[model samples]
Target: MDTWWLLAIPVIFGLGWIARGFDLKELLSESARLPRSYFNGLNFLLNEQPDRAIEAFIEVVKLDPETIELHFALGNLFRRRGEMERAIRLHRNLLERADLPVEFRDQALFALAQDYLRAGLLDRAESAFKSLADTPHADQAAGFLAEVYQLQSEWQLSIDALQRSGADTPAKSRTIAHLYCELAEAAIEHKDLKAARERLAQARAADAALLRIVQIEISIAAAEQAWARIVELADQTLAEHPEFAPQVVEAYIDAAQHVAFSAPGQRPLDTQLRSWFDASPNDALAAVIIKRLEAAGSMSAALEFARVALQRLPRLSQAHALLRLRAAMQGDGDEDLAHITQMMNGMLRSQKRHECRNCGFRAQRFFWQCPGCKQWDTLPYAASPVGP
Candidate 1:
């Protein structure tokens, strides 16, 4: 037994020696495979010269194809520099390799999708992203796919893609609601009332407080000549989102003209609007209320309403409204009206009609999305607080 143990020790030592030699040989080969350009690439990266670094890395990969990581790094740098065609070519080369592992292949496919997206090749991007639907990049790929569909105005497909996005559930649901609202707007433009109604219902179900859905509903009611329904939606919007009160003012006046709203022996349109103005105290809604009073033949009340609002809000717009009303009362005052109009125009020249509450970007035109930040429902009209 003692002799057998001594013999086994040498045999085990011989096997360990062989394994060590093989490991050292593999390490030396990898070290010898690294070219001078690999060090140059590292130096360039340390110096923050990414373009030159990318070029050097590309050379390193050409000399030693074992460095699969260099290919991805090169492709990403090309995409970042707006060289979409180069990125697409490099990633495609990786995808064509039969020896690539599943993870590396998925990485290559994702890079190719991004390249196609950056190049505005929507169809190709969509196809590539769809191939990654069940991979680790599923949520991220869905996000990009949603953006592509949104750009193409394919609202239903956009909503479907967003449902699979990486954003939290509430945010994803909100964006889906916005997409539904977009579909509703398109339906309204084409005079498809049934489709518009169905889309609005879907939008409300997704996001009940989305003010654009209310706006579109009011617009649909206006088209159907359902004045009372318009008033109902406007009032509900005001009660829930007072910031959106300004957008509903004109709807009130339009509805009042078509119907006298009497709530079971209560005051009609003029009284209800006055109550709303008193509750919210908005300049735009005040203007609408005053107009409604004047239409009801209460000129004195209208002038008093403007005067009282001027004393409280003390805004240039309110003062302008007061002066215009007084000028109207004066039978022969073209001079006064002209002066008031000139001053109003000057004030409006510096005033932005729209503002993004999220980024504080101001513009003269309203947008459903903030042009500066590209965030949905961020822009609100400056004259009125309405949703994007």
Candidate 2:
């Protein structure tokens, strides 16, 4: 009886080991079946059935907790749907796993950062993005950081982030210059002329062809009463960028007013204004020249300048200037002046101001960048008149 019991105990132990092996096989088969659910979820996603897809994916995640790809997919789907909290949860869960591979860990972190950004949690987003700044995703994160800084009006932080991220691409060079201009404008507003000058210099260095920087520099010189510097910069600016000459014509006139010339009888101002008027024939400049000539006791020269400008452009403003010069010279009464004024008003009604060629945005005031489309160097100086 003792020998029989010992033999039974050995057989019972062997059977128990076999049963445990079968249970292990069953678990393996169940886990293998989980991949089919994943495929089904992917197919549903491809068919644009998110509800059904999420159901299948959730089932798969329950069965196989280590599937990072499904988590990523679900996280991205939630983000696209604007369910940012859910997206953050899914990504945060993935990030918490110590067994996750390095690449997947980075991807989850990036997705989490995106969730924070979309949720307007900028502080959280900034922290999340800072971690990825030196990774493969650094460029995109840096760009987002720049935008965030801009939204916060933290110009210095934006500039610093852009510099760190290699922000100056060939396509974005103009934008970078504009960013510097914004900095300079803010500095000027705060009465920080030194800082403003530094920023303006940076802008010019970034894009020599940017005409707005030249305009700013001219204004700065005018404010400082640096007459010779103004003349030198204005002449260089006009020679380099004649398309913007009309905009800066007043500045040039102001600079000319400051310069002291020899020969008391010499009409130096008239000579300078006439040279510019002849070269450009711009209506705005011609008006300024007309006013200056009248002041210098050269009414005939002033009228001639207005006539030349009107003949060239046929603009209402130029014609008005011409009529005013004529009335002043002839000592006309209200009758003649009133008739010319009416005619000038009709011409003004017919004229259009500057238009943005890129976006078809029209405005009376010139913008270096189009407010409509935010495009740089898009607003043309010329107007598009209706019916010829």
Candidate 3:
């Protein structure tokens, strides 16, 4: 029986050795399709040694040229790491392969376009995206085209590209309007009033509710010295779009004063100004009133004007207009005037008048479109954008 047990022990160990040999054979066969460098690359990647991993992976790709997935992974890794030249080369090589599947061909083309764009090869990128026009990537390609055209200041091309893109919605109406307005603004800069007018008309057609058209129209009228027309247009537009009340009011006040001061024995525009202030006691309108009162040497009236403004707006352009007004009323003279002038300058310097409601991008001046997000009408009217 002891001898029988010793024989059984040898048989069990032999069976275990045979099983291990079979397992090792299977592992060797499976790993034979992948080079040893592939395992080294994976180990280096696991250790976060990307430079070494890349070198090892390149060795693997060279050893096994049919490693399609490995190529794609490595190519994308290069692109994300800002190695555009390598990404471009790898994707181009993939595209050159006639045996590549249709799906892979399209993916390679898109990746190639991205590589070109990242490298600032805009013309090449444009050509690549144009080739993708009729494919499933058409809409995405169109969006990139819009961005490219806008960046290049090709307003008409940008507008056409946006029209082709599937991103058009009621929400993007102001963006379309701005595209048209940009053309109008360009025309005006080039002294082409007729073309400017036409473009402005198109801008309004894109979004009838835009305040930009009114501002442009006022500017055009100013160029023609049509102060009366400027006032008329400002009033008409302000009636429908009261959100631009501050700007329209300022324009009207300026135009009215220009016409009033140009002619002799003409009544001052104070009546019109006072009437507007009575209807809408905005801080800007009140400020205008105080200026007129101070111009006429009425300190009491100017103090009263500032007091009334403070009731509606506690801080004028986020400055303590009320406290300053009280101090001026207490002091009351050239000292007060100098102090007030300094305060006004401070307010001007501190104020961020326009802000992108979409992206919270603040600006000292107004933008029809946000510089941060490139969206139109996102900059709302506010003297103090970042603060109450």
Candidate 4:
């Protein structure tokens, strides 16, 4: 037998003794009948007949009103079955008894808090959990409080509660970064660029490996028309995480454009564009290079650049760029355009925009958190094939 059963034997005998002293002969007799009903309820539970088992346990509670164990079991069962109302009623009744032991009372309060939490009565749940803050249940209550704060989108409160409970392990730091990112996004929405920048700094401090924070910072700098800052951040990001080169190409182009426009005689845009393209052969980057070449009155050079890129990435976008350049010279032809468009459509059909590597969830747009599994920084950018 388990050591808990050995410990419980003395409590059972004491309850029987107390019942006899109170001249509660019926209660004393009912104590003797407990084993049979308790075993029957266990059998029913093992058989997966939860309704029948709960009925048996309910009868046992009625007969032996002082049996705290039976009440706890029934309350837990109701909660497991999604019967929050019944679980709350049973736990509340146990809490009301003046004669109940302190341990049992604490257990009842914990159970009642769970009931309120499941019912979405967060205020009542918080109050009930607060009462257990000094008890053995404190750690568990604090963890639940963190979860409640997360649901309410109160990231700071959630972080505080998690720290108090010591539940914020190393693996949770990535999640902390995401929370800071969310705050940064909110600040951006409110047009508070300074606060948004501060939050992004905090996010990077929390988890230096978080590439999304760098991306967001670059975007904010671009929005503020801080061309130098944008270029600096984009360069740092690419140097740190080169695999995100494709995604950062557009920002880099925009930053270069801003610089070129700001200082016309400093350095030609083509020089910087050619240098980056030589360093990284990204389709998006190649596209930007072609556009820049065309803008500089060099359509023939742009065609040559597109052809060189096509050798590496035979995607529809590159092919379309080539076709448009050719048509601009030789006049429009539906056959060539139609063929390239069909190939592009075919490539897109096999592509997934984003996928959550943690949970295998696929979606069209990027999500910092997975909606299916609620994990932070789990989604990965998926590459689609280009056609010519």
lDDT of 4 by residue, 1-388 (tens): 5588888999999998997788787777766766677778989999999999999898878877877887888999999999999999999999999998898889899999999988889889878888888998988888778667777789887666666775556656777777778888888888899999888888888787888887788778877888888777766666555556666777777777667444544445566556666666655567778887888789899889889877776766677677767766665556776566566657665665567888887775567778766677677643445333
Model 2: ten consecutive residues of lowest lDDT: 379-388
lDDT (C-alpha, whole model) for all candidates: 0.82, 0.75, 0.77, 0.77
Residue 176 displacement (Å), model 2: 1.5
Q: What does the lDDT read for residue 92 in candidate 2?
A: 94
Clashes of 1: 0
The C-alpha RMSD of each candidate to the native structure, in angstroms, is: 7.5, 14.0, 10.9, 9.8
Considering TM-score, which of the candidate structures 2 and 4 is the better prediction for this target? 4
* Superposed model 2: Cα runs more than 4 Å off: 1-154, 160-167, 263-267, 324-343, 346-352, 381-388
Of 1 and 2, which scores higher on lDDT? 1
User: Which stretches in model 4 have alpha-carbon errors above 4 Å?
Assistant: 1-34, 40-67, 231-253, 256-364, 381-388
Question: What TM-scores do the predictions have?
Answer: 0.69, 0.57, 0.66, 0.60
Query: How does candidate 2 score on lDDT?
Result: 0.75
User: Candidate 1's error at 208, in angstroms?
Assistant: 2.2
Candidate with better lDDT, 1 vs 3: 1
